[model samples]
Target: MDEVEVVVAHSERATLRVGDMFLKVDADQARIDAEVAAMALAPVPTPEVLWRKPHVLAMAALPGTTVGRLGGPSTGSPGAWAAAGAAIRKLHDAPLPPWPGPGRRPDELRRELDEECEALVTNGVLPADLVTRNRQVAEAALRPWTPAFTHGDLQIAHVFVEDDEVTGIIDWSEAGRGDALYDLATFTLGHEEHLDDVIAGYGTDVDLAVIQAWWALRSLLVVRWLIEHGFDPFTAGCEVDVLRSRM
Candidate 1:
């Protein structure tokens, strides 16, 4: 019998790997549905869905390692990062998904950020100056944008590659119509060194300022959630460093 390896386990969801199969257990049916639908609609490679039962969805694992992970060195070459960027561009070019993405509403994001910022300052999780500076930087991202098909969480860990070729991207539950830059920003969050390579493959002019703003915005918004979920945002090359870099 194949031993089940826990890939990730948090309050919201847990993923397990048993041999070649990856099983995702999510409590939210809607999120699962969206993941399935997004995978079907995405132009890029995705895990092969085997079966789904209630809150559990089974899939065949893709054959490649992630390009990199936050707070860790990226083992992939520049070409691999560029390939991932090209794949992202393809997804963004595809027709918009039927459902709206979580990033579509900037006002809601502002409110959430405000709350989080207040909590961070009041609780002394981060110094007020750091929070204030990042908030100011984050404001640039809270503006109108032309919606595109987006992988709402395009963290480096979600993109898989082998030998400079993008094999697949995973974790599509947040996929929907949203700002394209958000995806770009998420992809290059901790791996800022690869931004140029990514932009080269993206094959279009990008707003560096907006992308920078997203780095701060995303880091700030997720720090608290990451802590609560047993993730260490303060790791040397992680979210806290990303925010500190803005200082």
Candidate 2:
């Protein structure tokens, strides 16, 4: 993999391309190694290849820029969204090994929401009452479902496409067993206009209200993050618009 000199190396991960191997470094490789192994054992059409050694090397490369960089109308096209849904279905259908990490509990999720909301309120980006109300809604909506393996960060940026089809998914660091709807929620909230397409692609008759609740919760979560980070008011205001529309 050293054939292509290191072009970019972050503190936590490095990107290297040598021949057919595109390697990414993980300070903690055990989880990723397990995830990859699980993918291999399951019947799924994912990226092919493996590690040369733990933290020493890993390899797999597919041709195509991230879907995010290919900013065409196609990014939000029905075909693209359908492809993404199909990809997610494949992942969800894969048999996951028993997860070992501290899973996201309702109380823990609530605590995180409260902390983020409090930070946003303290930063003067949100009203205390609004945060409280959103928190309540989030807690209630999340109560009905049990956790499952979810792609924690399932945004358009993480999707990969080649020859007009989704070929592979990247960034396995956030992969974990969590509320399955959380993945669907992220996809739908970010692509509201394509909700029908996404739902159809998933091939499920999910409750509309539950889906909307998840969408609202995801939007509030993002808005809370942006606000806490002290982003420009314009950015925060745009997030507010998204959050409001869902409610």
Candidate 3:
């Protein structure tokens, strides 16, 4: 039997790799549905959906290593970053999916931001003033946006590259219609130093302020979740470091 490697296992979800197959197990059925739907709609390369059960999704593994990791220098060439940028552009321009769910709704997101900010400050997980500043910066991203196909969680690890070209992107559970810049922001967060390389390939005008705002907003909101999931956000170079850089 092929050894089953635990990719990541948390209370809400887990991923395991067995030989050539990657299996995702999540208690949330809707998320699995959204991932399947979005991958079917996206124009960019994505893992091939093999089969799915109520709590499990299986996909054919793609070739190539990940583009990079957060809080670490990317070994990928600038051109690969550009290629990823170009892929994002293509996805954003493609036809919208038949149905985009309640995506980053203004009211809901505001409530979430407020709650998460309060939690961070109250828990002493982050300095109150730092949370306050980032929350304020997050105001820029709270405004309405023309929805576009977004990889909802476009972290660097989700993008795969081979020979300076994007071979595939994984983790579509967060994929949906939302702010295009949000995807860019999430993809570039913790690695702001590479913004220029990405933009050079994106070849389109983007609001830097909004992107920066998202970096702060997303970091602030996800810190608590990371803590609960057995991940550390305050380690030397992690989400907390990303937040501190903004200060």
* Clash count for each candidate, listed in order shown: 0, 1, 0
Q: What is the C-alpha RMSD of each candidate to the true structure, in Å?
A: 1.2, 4.6, 1.6
Q: Compose the digit string of candidate 3's lDDT tens values, residues 21-82.
A: 77989999888888888888888998899999999999987788766788667888888989
Compute each candidate's TM-score over C-alphas.
Answer: 0.97, 0.72, 0.94
Cα-based RMSD of candidate 1: 1.2
Most lDDT-accurate candidate: 1
The TM-score leader among the candidates is: 1
lDDT of 1: 0.91
Q: Provide the lDDT at 191 for model 2.
A: 51
Give lDDT tens digits, candidate 1, residues 1-247.
3599887789998888889988999999888988999999999999999999999999998788987788999888989988988999999999998988776488988999999999999999999999999999999999999999999989887888988888888889999999999999999999899999999889899999999999999999889999999999999999999999999
- Candidate-wise lDDT, in order: 0.91, 0.60, 0.86
Instruction: Give me candidate 2's TM-score against the actual structure.
Output: 0.72
Candidate numbers sorted by TM-score from highest down: 1, 3, 2
